[model samples]
Target chain A: MSRPSDVYLFGTCLVDLFMPDAGMDAITLLETLGIRVHFPQAQSCCGQPAYTSGHPREARDVARSQLDLFPGDWPIVVPSGSCGGMLKHHWPTLFAGEPEQERVVAIAARVVEFSDFLLNHLDWQPVDTGPATRVAVHTSCSARREMNVHTTSWALVDRLANVTRVVHDHESECCGFGGTFSIKHPDIAGAMVTDKARALEDSGAIEFVTADAGCLMNINGKLALDKATPLRGKHLASFLLERTGGKS
Target chain B: MNSQPVTLYPSRQFKDNARAALADTELRGSLRSAMDFLMAKRSSAFPDTDELDALRTLGEAIRQRCLSRLPELLEQLEERLTANGVTVHWAETPAQANAIIHGLVAARNGTLMVKGKSMVSEEIELNHHLEAHGIQALESDMGEYIVQMAGEKPTHIIMPAIHKTKAQIARLFHEKLPDTPYTEDVDALIRIGRNALREAYLQADVGLSGVNFAVAETGTLCLVENEGNGRMCTTVPDLHIAITGIEKVVEKLEDVVPLYSLLTRSAIGQPITTYFNMISGPRRPGEKDGPREVHLVLLDNGRSQAYADQQLRKTLQCIRCGACMNHCPVYSRIGGHAYGTTYPGPIGEIISPHLLGLENTRDLPTASSLCGACGEVCPVRIPIPEMLMRLREESQRPAGEAVDHPLRGQGAAASTTEALAWRAWRRVYASPGTYRLFGWSATRLRALTPPTQAGWTQNHVPMTPAPKTLHELVREREARRKES
Candidate 1:
C-alpha cells in the first residue's frame, strides 16, 4: 500500500542470463522511479519447470524458499511475465493447502510485474528518449491472462510520443517455450514457435518486443533456425531502456 | 469421408475411420480451413474480454452440481412434467428408448416424424429403427438435411455439414433439388434448404428435439440454436418428444443460470445465443401453438458409467459448449467423421467408447496429438487431455506411433519395434540412476543422430535429455549451497 520497505527485484532466470541488460535496466528503472530495489542473491529459478511439469511438491519446495527469502511489504518487482505469472497465478496453486499459504498470498498482493509497475503506479513524463520508432508488441499469454499487462504496457509505450506501437494480430497465441516444454516436446514446440515467428514476419514490422524472456528466447531461437529476418525479439525493459536512451 | 467397412472393436474395420481420415488429404484440408475460420470468428467476438473466465467458473460449478444428484433431479423433472399434463417416459437403454418412441408413434399410427438436429436420436439410430418399422424421419436442420440427402452422417457436432465442402453440398442439393441450380454461396444454399424443410416442419405428425439441459425443479428443457427450426419442430406438431440423457438434469432453476454463462460463450463464443428457449412441461391452458401432448424421454444409455467413476462423472457436467471441439487439434485435422461416432473431439473420445463400446472405438482416444490446447480452451476446465489419457489406458488399441510401451499385458499384441522402444524406456525410467545414465548416453549420441528419430520421431520430437539430469543438477546445487 505504502512505499515498499524494500523492493525485491526478481530478475527472472531467463533475463538474468540471456538478456542481463534487461535485468539491470529493470533494477535501475525501478530505483530511478523512486523505489528501493533489492536483488536477493539467494534467489534461484522460480520452479516454473516443476510446477508446469506437474511436479507440485518440488514446485512448492522452491516456492517456500522464495517465500522465506522475500518477506515484508516490499513490492516484488518481476520483469518477466513467465516468472511473474508463475508467482502471480501458479504459486498460490502450489502452496494452496499449506498453512504458510497465507504468507505467500500476502506476498503475491505486493508482487508487481515490471510493465505493471510503470503503467499503474508511475505517472512518468517518460525520460527524453531521443525518439520512439515503429514498434510491434507481443503480449505473452501469462502477461495477458495473469497480469493484465497489455493495456498497461500499451499506455506506457504510447506515452512516448515517437513510438508508433502496433499490436500483432496473432499476438494472443503462445510462443511455445512453455519452460522445459521446448526441449522436452520439441516438435510441437517448434511448430508453435514457427507459427509465432511467421506471424511476426507477416506483421510487416521492423521490431518485436515481449514481456517474457522465455518467449523472446524461443521466438529468437526459432527465428534464427528459420533464417527469417528484418524482425527481432527484444525484452520490454530492453526496448524501454533503448527508447529512453539509457544505453542501446 | 473415406469409405471403410464398419466392424466391432479393434477390428480390421473400425480403426480404419481415423486412418482413412488422416490419409484423406482433401477432407483434412477442409477441416483445417473450417476450424481456423470458426476459431478466428470466435476470437474476434470475444476479444480479450473480462467476461470470459468469470462465465466459465460459474458454468463449471452449476454443471457439477447437476450431475451429482442427477437421478433425484430426473424423478422431480418427471413428476413436474407429468403434472403439467404432458406424458413423460424413461428409457434405460437405446433399445428401450426406441421402443418407447415407437410405441408412442404407433399409438398415433404416425407415418412421418420431423426431426430437429438431435445428437441423441443419432446416438440411438432412432431414424433407422423407425424406417425399418415403416416410418419416415425427416431431418429439419439445414446441415442435417444436406447430410441426409447425400446418405452421409454428420462430421462435426456444431458444423455437421463441415466435412462437405460448399462445392460438394452444391452437388448434393443439385441431385436432391433438380430445379435449383448448383450454387456454392452459403446464403443461397441456406435459402434452398429452408425452401425444402419448411413444409416438413409444418406437416409431420410428431416433432423431436434433443434437450441441451433440463431443469429438474421446474421440469424445463432448454433447446438452444441459431435457427428457429427447433421451435417449429417442438411446437407445430401435435405431439413433441424431447429425448435427452439422465445426465442432462439439474436440481434447480438457478443452476441453469451459471451454465448459460459458459454455454453460449463456449458454443459460439457469444455472451449468449440468438435463441435460448426453455419449455417447462410443454403446453398448458389453451397455449396457442405448443404441442398438445409432450413427452420428455430421459434416456440413460451409458451415462451411468460416467456417474459411477469419480474422475469421469464430471464429464456429465459438460454443457456441450463445443469449445473443446472447437479447440481440439485432432478434430481440426480429421473432422468428426474420423471418430465414426455421433459425438467427436476430446470429450467425445472419452464418452463415445462407453456408448459405442471400448474395443471398436479405441482409435478416437489415440487420434490426439496431446497438445493440451483443448484442455486450456475448455470453458468448464474439464482437463480434457487428462481424460483422453485415461481413455487411452482403458483402450485395447495398439500404442500410437509416439507412445512406447515396454510391457504389453496379456491378449494385447506387442510388435517388435514397440517392444524394443518400451524396453529402452523401462531401462531408463526404472530408476533415477538409470535415467541419469541414459541422459548422459543420449547427450553423447546427439552428435551422431539425424535431425529426427528413425520412425516415431518424425511427427513428434523425442524428449531431449538435458546436459545434467534434474537430480544431478539439484544435488550439485545443494552441495554448492552447503559448501558456501
Candidate 2:
C-alpha cells in the first residue's frame, strides 16, 4: 500500500490520561513527516482491558463506539500496539456474527501500529540530532506477538545514528503489565516487573523507551517505587520525536 | 505398600501459593536458570525458523484432523487393539479408570505394580488408589522414582523431580533408602535410583505405562522418553497396563512421525528422544520376553468436554511438550507445583478447567498474563492465550445462563461487584461524551489519585494522570493550526 497523506490517531486511554505528551509527540512526529494526523476526539479506550479480561460484551460495546469515528478509509494509526492489535486482529472476532461485523473488519484492515506505520508505510529514516547516549527498548508482548511490530519499533530506534541501542536480558519477556493481570495477580506481576526493571538497569542504558504505554507505566512505576535504579522509561514515539529534532 | 497418600495442593490457593513461591529465592533462581537453559536448547534445536514453522503447521493440522474424527478414531483404536490381543477398557472418569485397572490387577492377584512415567496416573491419583487396596505401585522412571520416594507429587510432567536440586535429591535418597551414601554427582544419583528400582522391576507382578500416541490404524501404543524404564515396564513384567487420555488417538502410524518430531524437539530440544517404544499388543505365542498380558485403558475424564467445543478442542492438540511452560514468564517464577494441578503452566491453565471443574480451577485460567509466549512456542500451535481468555469468559458467565454447551463450572469466578464495575466501565467508554467527562475529571483531579491503589501500588508507585488530557492538547494544536 502507498503512503497516505492523512491518518487517524487513536491515542489510547493510557496515553490520553497518564502520558498525554507521548500522544502529542506522536502527533508531532506524524505531522513533521508531512502527514495529516487526525486525532479522533471521540475515541477513548480500545476496549482491550475489557476484552482481555473476558468481558467481550463490554469490550464490543466500547469498541463499537470507535467503529464509525474513522470512516474515511484512511489508516487508523494507533500509538499503542496492544490497542492496535485489538483493532487490527481482535475487533472482527469480537464482532463476529454481529450486524457491524463487516464494518469492524473494514476498520480492522485500516489499523496500523505507530512504528509500523512510520517504518513500513512511510519508510521513515530518522536522522539522529540529539546527544549521543545509550538507551534500551522494551517492546510490549502485544507488540511482539499480536501486532508483530516489535521489529519495526527496534528498526525505528536503530535508525537513530548517534543513539546506541542496548539489549537487555530477557528483552522479549513481558513486563507483567497484562492489563487486569497485574491487578489480579500482584505478587506474580511484581516479581516479573522487578526482574524486568533489574534487567533494564543492568543493561547499562541510562533510560528505556517502549511503544506501548502500559509497559511504560509498569516499568516506570516499578523503578519509581524501587528508587534503587536511576533508569527511567518513555514512550517510543516521544523518544523518537525528541531524537529526530522534533519538538517534544 | 503402606506408603502415605499423595498430598494435593488445591488450585484455589493459587494466590497464596504464588506468594510463597515468589518469596523463595532459591526456587526463583533454580527455575530461572532451568528455564533459561531450556529456552536456549529449544532455540538451538529449531535453528531454522522456516522449517520449525512448517513442522508446527503440519503438527497442528494433524492434531486438528485427528481431533475432528476423535470419536471414530477412538472406536477404531479399541477395535484394532482388541484384534491385536490387547484388552481395551473405556473409562469416562478417573474413578472408573482406577476401578478397571484395579480389577485387572485383582484378576492376576497382583501385589506389586512397577510403573514408568505417566501423567495420566497422577491425574487419576492411581498410586494412592492402589495403595489403598494394599497394592504397591512403584515408579521406575528416575524422576518419578525420586518424587515417589520423597512422597511428593511430580512437579513437572516431563521431569517429575525438576523442582528438586541435586543436593536435595541426594539428601532425599540418603534419608529414604538403606545404605545409600549421600552423593551430589548426577551420574552417581542416577545409578543409585536405578539400583533402587532394579529390584522392583524384577519382582513386579504387573507393570504400568503411559501412551503418547495410540494409532488406530496400526493398534500401536507409542511411548517417548529418554529413560529405558518405559521399555522395561512394558516388557519385563508379565502383565503390562498402559493408560492414557482418549484424546491421544491418532488416525495412522505415519501421522506419529511429525508429531513425535515436534514433541521431542519442542519438549527437551532433542531432535528425537533416546527411546521411542511401540507396543502393539501382548506378546505373541512365538514372542520370547515381552509381557504376556497387555491392557489399554482410555480415560475420558473431562477430555470429552474440551473436545465438545470447537475452540477449546485445540487444547487436546498439545503433544505434552513443556515448551509452553519453559517459555512462560508466570510459570518461570511460580514453578509447576504452584499450579496445584497434574499439568502445569499454559497447557494446565486451559486444560485444568475442563479436567477439574472451572469452580476448582477458576484461578488457573486467569493466572497468565496472556503474553502469547506459550502459544508462540507450542509445537502443535495450540492458541493457549486465546483459550485462557475463553475459559475466563466461561468461568465468568452468569450461572444458569442459557447456552448450548455450558462448561461444568460455568460462572464459578463471576462476581456481582466485578460485573457491576465492567458495566459502569462500559457506560463510560462506550460513549464519547461520558469518556471525555471522565478523562477531564481524571486529569484535573490527578493530585487526588490515591497513592494506595490496590495491587498496582504493591510493587510500583501510584499511577497518576497527567495534568491535561490528550484530547485537550490535540484541540489546542488544532487551534494553532487554524491560526496559522
Candidate 3:
C-alpha cells in the first residue's frame, strides 16, 4: 500500500532528550512504509504541566506555540502517549471559554497517540525479528484511555519470534511522574514508583517494560531509589530493537 | 508507624500496587466477588433507565447551585433549624467541631453518645473528644460498628468492612462478642451485629448522625441509608446531634431528589437505598418517639475554601455513594489506611488536604493513577481525577519545604529531569515541515529504536510510525469527495 504524504512527528520532550533514538526509530519506521515524515522545528512541550496544574495562562502560551508551530491540518503524531494524551484531551479544555476555542478544535482533530496511529492507519504488523527475548509490558493512563494503545502494543509484541512477554500486572497504574507531580510530591512520588518497580520485579520478566519514557524513568528511578529487589525498566522500542539487533 | 508514608512507586507505583493487590488470591477473590456483586446489583436496581442519567444531570445542577449559594443556604438552615426546637451551631474547623461536640455532651451531663455513619464525625475525631470527657460513643451501623469494633477505620465508604475476610470477622466477632457464639456465615454475622447494636441504640440518650442532605425549604433534615440505625439515631433519642459540612445543603426538596437518587446508584450499585428518611421538627406533644429537641451543627471546616475556588466547587456535588472509591485503582491497593484520614480514595485525597491542612494530608493527592475511572463511575460524575491532579498542582506551586509537603523538595513544580525533557522536545516538531522530516527519519530507524528508547520498548513492541499522515489522507479523501 502506498503511504500517505506529509507525516509530521511531534517528538515529546522526554523522547527528544532522554532518548532520541525512539524519535529516529519512529522516522525510520514511517519512511520504510513509504511515508515522508516532517519534524516541526518550533514544536515544544504540550503545556500539560500548566494545564494539569490549573495554570491556564501558561498552558495557553505553550498550546498556542504548539498550534502556531503545527498550523494547518497535518495528522500530528507524538511518540509519548503522555504528550499525545495531553494534546488530544487537555488542549481543548484550554479553549473552553476563550477566543482560541476554534484553534483548539482544529488541532484536537489532528492529534493521535503514535501507537494507535500505526495500528489503525498503517495496519501495523510486527516486523520479522531475528531473535526473541523475555520482556514485560506496562501501559500508561495516557495511552490506556486516550488511545487504547496498550492492546495494540501487546498485540504487536506478541507477534515477535522467540519472545516471551510478561504484561504489567497493574497495566493501568500511574508512575506518579505527572508532569510537575513528581517533584512537588517527591516522597509520595517516590513511594508510588517504588511500588511500580516491585510490580516489575514480580512480572517475572527479566526487564520491566512500558510505552512511555516518563513512566519508565519514574519507575526506574524508584527502583534505584529504594534499591528494589528485582526487575529493571526498559522502553518498548528498545526491547523490540534488541531482538532484531537494530539499534541497541 | 514508619513515620514515612508507604509508597508503591512514582508514576508506575499505583500500577504495581494495584497489580500486587489484585493478584493476592484472597484479596482478589473477595474484592472481585464483592465489587461485581455490588456493580451488578446497582445496575439491576437502576435497570437502564434514562431517568438515572437525567437524575444525575439534575443532581449535578442542584449541587452546583447549592455550592454557589452555600453561605446563604447555610444561614437559612441555621435559622430554620433553630426555629424548629433545635439548637444550631457553626464550626469553622475540625478542632472547633470536636470542641463543640465535647462541650454539648459535657453540658448534657452525658458520658455516652450513639453515632450513625457520619464521615464528618471521623474527620473531627468526635469520639476522642467524647472519650476525653469520659464519654464513650458507640458506632451503630453494622459495617461501621464492625470496623469500629476491629479498631480500624472504614476502608470502603458504604461497605466499610469490604477489606475484611470472613475469618477475620469471625475472629473479631469472637473477640468483641464474648457472650455470643462467633459465626462465619453472613446472615449469622448480621444477627450478631444487630443484637450488639440494638442495646447501644436503646440506651444512648444523645444520638449523632451525618446529614446526607439538609433541606433549607422547610427546615428539614434527611439521612439516606440501608440500615435501620440511621432511622433510630434521629428518632430514638431524647436529644440528637447532626454534624454536617455546609456543602450538603440543598435549596429545595426537588433539588434533593436527583442528588439522593445518584447517591444510591453510585454507592453499592443500588437503584435506591432501602431507606431515605426525612426528619422535620423534633417530637411534638404526645409524641411516642424521637428526640424532644433536635440539634443541627453545620461545620464549615475547609468547605468555604473549596467553594472560593470555582474549579473545585464541582466537588460539592458528591453524594458520598463511594462509587469513585470502589472503582479506584489506588484505593484497591493501599485500601483506606494508607490515606491516614477519615476520608479515603480519590474524593478523600482531594478534600482531606483542605480539611486537615495540606501538611498532614499532602500525600493523599499523589496516591492516584489519574486513570479517569473515578470520574466515569461517579453518579454525579465529579471529575475526581482532574480535581486530584489540581490538588497535586496546588501543593507543588507554593515552593514550600516541609511546610505543606512533608519532604523538603516534595511538591516542587520544577524538576531538572522534567525541565530538561521539555527543553529538548521544544527543539523539534514545532512545524509541519520539520515534523514530516522527523517522522520519515523515525520510520527509517524503526529497526534501531530499542537502544534509542530503551525504557519505553521494554514491555511492548513499539509500533512503527504510521506510513501515511492521517491529515494527508483526510485531505485527499475530502478533495476526492469534493471532485465527485
Clashing pairs in 1: B9-B359, B9-B360
Q: What is the iRMS for every candidate structure?
A: 9.0, 0.6, 8.9
Per-residue lDDT for A3 in model 3? 38
Root-mean-square deviation of every model: 7.6, 1.1, 8.8
List DockQ for all candidates.
Answer: 0.08, 0.90, 0.10
Off by over 4 Å in 3: A1-4, A17-35, A42-44, A47-67, A92-106, A115-139, A146-248, B1-55, B79-85, B103-107, B399-484
**What's model 2's TM-score?**
0.99
Q: What is the TM-score of each candidate against the true structure?
A: 0.70, 0.99, 0.73
C-alpha lDDT score of every prediction, in listed order:
0.69, 0.91, 0.69
Ranking by DockQ: 2, 3, 1
Top-TM-score candidate index: 2
lDDT value, residue A77 of candidate 1: 83
Indicate the worst ten consecutive residues by lDDT in candidate 2 chain B.
B1-10
Candidate 2 segments whose C-alpha is farther than 4 A from its true place? B1-4
Which structure is stronger by TM-score: 2 or 3? 2
